[model samples]
Each structure stands twice: as structure tokens, then as C-alpha cells.
Target: MVDHMIILLRSISAFVILLIITRFLGKQTLSNMNFHEFVTAVILGAIAANFAFNEKMQVIHLLISLAVFTFTSYLLSIIIVKNRKFRMWTEGTPTILIEGGKILEDNLKKNHLTLDTLNQMLRQKDIFDYSEIEYALLEINGKISVMKKKEYHNVTLKDLKKGSKDLGNFPIELIMDGQLLEGNLKVNNIPPEWVMDKLTARGKQLDDVFYAVKGSNGQLYIDFYNDKITHPIDIE
Candidate 1:
């Protein structure tokens, strides 16, 4: 029981330390963490786990190790930010895989990307036909950025030479889980009476709504708690 208590306490301590280090490293460490940053995080996690659960390992020694690794990574981040050449060396430049609707086989070979993989990536970007791509770049983080040809690109009102009007902000949630969000309604200038009228028209009360939002198109999108769809297609 004592041993378990020790492990629990150590685990909590390690978690707190790691959380502080992560916050110090900033949000980018999680959001846009490159290859090196990712490896550093993995290593730190392993070290923390070892000291937390493994009684054989000295807690002080592991803490010191974690501190050193985190400090080194933080210092390297600073250097990378200040030095352009260092940044390029650490995080390789984006490679152009496709140009002018033509596949660069040499570049693909260099990146070790197979035609099948390329096609899969293209399909992810909603491009089934490679011929429709104007440019496709393999980013430093291994994600593919694609640009479709003018003909294949999505058309907007501006493309049709139509004057653009303010379409309000994106859907603001006025209600969620049958709870009214008066603050959101006030911020969005949505009156409660307008919401009630809409709900009444659909024969739904506020309590019946599981989720509700005021869309940018000036429409109320409401999902009911009892709502059911027989054939739910999986898009993802």
C-alpha cells in the first residue's frame, strides 16, 4: 500500500512538472510541434513515466534529466526562431511534389512517397483526379498542402462578380444541452422571442433542444435530444 501511495504521489508530481514545462514551452509545442519537438516530448514523457512508476530509478535524478532535456529543447526553440538557417536545417523546407498538374517523380522518390500514397493524400484534399491539381506541396510536418486548378476550385459569390454582403459571424451557440446561453444571445443580438417563435413553429420547446446555434446565414440550426436519423452515412 505504501509503495502504491509513493507511485501515485510521484506520478502526480511528474504530471504537474510536465504540465508546467509544456505551458512554458508554449502552445506551439502541441499545435505545430515539428519532428524534433515531437521526439523531445516523447523522450520527456518516457523519463517522467520511468521515475514515476519505477522505484529503482532515483526521483531526483529523473527530475534533473527532465529539466535538462526540457531546457535544451526550450533553448533550441529560441535559437531556431532567431536563426533562419538553423530553422531550415532543423525543420526541412516544404517540398513541391506536384507542379502544373504534373507529378514530379524525382521529388516523390526523394521523399519516399509512393504513387498510391500520393493518390491517397490527394483524395484527402477532395481531389480524386491528379490532373486537377495546380500545385501540391509536402509540408515539413508531413502534411500535404494542395492547390486545385482554377477550373476545379470552388466558386464563391465574388467569383460570379456578385457584391458581397455581411453574412454575420459564424454560428454562435445560444443554447446547448437544453440550457439557454443568455450571454451568447446578448452578444449576438439575438432576441429570446425570435428563438421561441422558431422553436414553436417546429413544435419544439427549449428543453427539447440538445444543441442550437444562430448561423451566419441568419438561420437557426437546432438539434433535438430525441431527433433520430435512420440512415446515418459515415462521411469520414
Candidate 2:
């Protein structure tokens, strides 16, 4: 009687605590969770389960443990967001699986992904033929992003006309969350002055910008923090 009531109360307390903790740690969906998130979720669940069911265990002890883990994880997430190198180390960078229709055997081995798994993922995207892929990347979330060859792509209205504009390579991110990616600028040989000039021309400062990317058409696309959208759809 008393034991059963205690168990019910413990279960409710655990559930509420879990909900609060998960809300604070919200970032990725279950389908797109990284390794760090996956591990954190598993451990949190185990701790929560013990808290809910283990009548012999001290509630305060379990709570202290949860608090330590949650705080550490939250701190790590903040560090990952601010420090790019740490982020790469913890979450890992995307690997190029296929480039120019050629599968990179070394990359496949590095990721420890078998050819069969690769084929299955590719087929999920309706990409059956390896030769059709111009570029395929294995994202940190274990999903594959593929870019098909021009010939394999669907015929667009642009293709119907002669002397169509040349679509430049993949889009390159310049400023993410108002932080300038110096490495990207250096690697792509994009002049720092160019970014400043673009921002200046629009009468905006770097801090005002939310995100900026170089489009595939070799043009700069910039978005500001203050979108100034009046009567924006309030969905949610």
C-alpha cells in the first residue's frame, strides 16, 4: 500500500524531471541525433528508470547524479557551439563517400560503413546507380546527402533554353549565427574584404546578420537577425 504509493510518486517525479531536462537539452530530433546526444539520452533514461523503480536507492543521490550529468552535458553543448574544433572532435565532420561518380574506398573504410550499407542508404534516396552521383557525403547524423550528375538530374526549364547560366559548385557558408568562418574564407580564397563590402553595401554590420552563404550561382545570400517581417505566420 505505502510502497505502491511511493513508487507512483517516484515515477511521476522522474517523468517531470526528465521532461524538464530534455527540454533544456533540446537540439536534434531523434532521427538526426549525433553520437554524443544518443549516449546522453541512453544514460539519462537509465538513471531515470532507476530513480522511478529502485525503492532501495536514495532519491537525493539519484537527483544529484542527474544534476551533475545534465550540467556537464549542457556545458559541453555550449562549448561545442562556440568552438568549431571541439565541435568537430565531439560530433565529427562529414565524410565524402562519392566524388565525381567514384566511390572512395578509403573513406568508406574510415567510416567503417560497408558497401551494402552505402547502397541501401543511396537506394533510400532513389539513387540506384553509383555513376549517377556527382557527390555523396555521409553526414554526422548517419544520413547520406547526394548530388546527382547533371545528366541524371530532372530536366528544368533552364535546361530547355540555350546558353543557360552555369550553376556554380555547392553553396559555401560564410557567416553562421553571426560568427565569420575564417577557415572557409581562407580555404575558398574568398577575400575577407568581400564579406565586409557586402555587409557595408546593405548598410548592415556583421553582428546584424544572422547567417550568410555563398550560393551555387556564385552570388552572396545574406539574412539578417531582424527579419522585419510584419504579420509573419505564427505557427507554434
Candidate 3:
């Protein structure tokens, strides 16, 4: 067995050294790491991992290596921050993935993102399809920013310019734990038959659906057989 005591001691040493080095590296290293800085980070991780188990290697050696890496990264970060041209070249700007109600297929390919992958990211922000999205930006941090269609969003009295309903439009639960919701069906002027038809059209089994909700505008959202989910299907 690997020596637990050695691992514990080495881990403690690594943590202390890494903390000091990271502090010296500054906030930009974590928040906005450029290509060269990122490469240096990977090298640092490799160096840290290799020395973390070397019983003969003193912790000071690791600390020294970390210090050098941190100094380089910190210097680069300041250079990038001060120079707009350098920043643009280093981190790159956010790419418009979807523009003017259409998917930029060239941009999508440039970013090596498939339509399915983009849709999955969009759904993370409660956006499901291209039809519902107006603008999509792939940020430098590798995160997606999405803007929904105007009709899909909540319409305040100011937006409508009239007092339509003397109430608030609340998101209603249409299905929970694989059960068809009669209450929400009645609320949305939708029959249970419509729910069954929608699910059938999608070719998704109700039992296979992990989440389903009817949002403010009576838009039905259903997630079918998501492997990432950990919960067992509730078949009531």
C-alpha cells in the first residue's frame, strides 16, 4: 500500500506551498488565464504532482519552483491587463454563437461546438432550442451567455403598458416525479390529454422524464432520460 503518513505529510506541504505561490500569482491567473499562462499552470501542476510524492525531495524545492512559476504568471497577467492588444490576443474575445435569430454555424465550428452541445448549455439556463434564443455568446471563460426571445420572457405591466391580470405570473409545476399534474392542467387551460400528446410527439416516455414544468407563458419543459442525473425515477 502507498504510505498514508507520507501522503499526508506531502499533502500538507504541497498545500502550504501552493497557497503561497497562488497568492503571489494574483487573481487574474485564476480568473483569466491566457494560453501561455495556462500552459505554465499545467506545468506547475505536473511539477507539484511529481514532487508531492518524492520522499527524498525537500518541500523547499517545490516551493522554489512554485515561486518561479507564480512570478512568471503574475508578470504576464499585468502585461495583459495593461495592453488591450495583448489581452485580445491572449484570451480572445467572446464569439457570437447565435446572431439575429440564426445559428452561426461557422462560429460554432470554429469553437468546435456542435448544435447538440450548444443546446445542452442553453438548457442549463432554462433555454431549450434555437427558436427560443435570440443571441448566444461563447465567453472567453468557456461559458455560454444566452438571450431568450422577447415573447418567452415575463411581461410586466410596464412591458404590456396595461394592467392585464391583477396578479403575478408564477411558474407552475406541470409534472413532478413522473406524475401528471391535474392542478396545473386546470390552471393552464391544458387538458391531461395535451400533456400526453406533447410527450408522445417528442417520442419520450413519461416514466423516462426526470423533470417537467410549465413556465409563466404556459411553455412546457421536459427533460427526458438525462444520464447525468443521479436520482432514481419516481414511477408513481
- Per-residue lDDT tens digits for candidate 2, residues 1-236, read 99999999999999999999988887452457777778888888999999999988899999998998888788888898777778889999888999888999999999999999999999999999988988899999989999877667777786788544555376678987787889889999998899999999999999898899998668899999899998889545
**How would you encode candidate 1's per-residue C-alpha lDDT over 1-236 as one tens digit per residue?**
99999999999998999999998888878787787799889999999899789999998899889999999999999987766568879998888899878999999999999999999988888889888877889999888998766666666878579744445244477777676878778987878888889899999899898888886456778999886887879754
Off by over 4 Å in 2: 1-9, 27-31, 155-165, 229-234
For each candidate, the alpha-carbon lDDT, in order, equals 0.84, 0.87, 0.74
Candidate 1, overall lDDT? 0.84
Q: Provide the RMSD of all predictions against the true structure, rounded to 1 decimal.
A: 15.3, 3.0, 18.5
Return the top candidate by TM-score: 2
What local lDDT does model 2 show for residue 117? 99
Give the TM-score of each candidate: 0.66, 0.81, 0.59
Candidate 1 off by > 4 Å: 162-236
Best candidate (score: lDDT)? 2
- Model 3: lowest-lDDT 10 consecutive positions: 163-172
Better of 1 and 3 by lDDT: 1
Give the lowest summed-lDDT range of ten residues in model 1.
Answer: 163-172
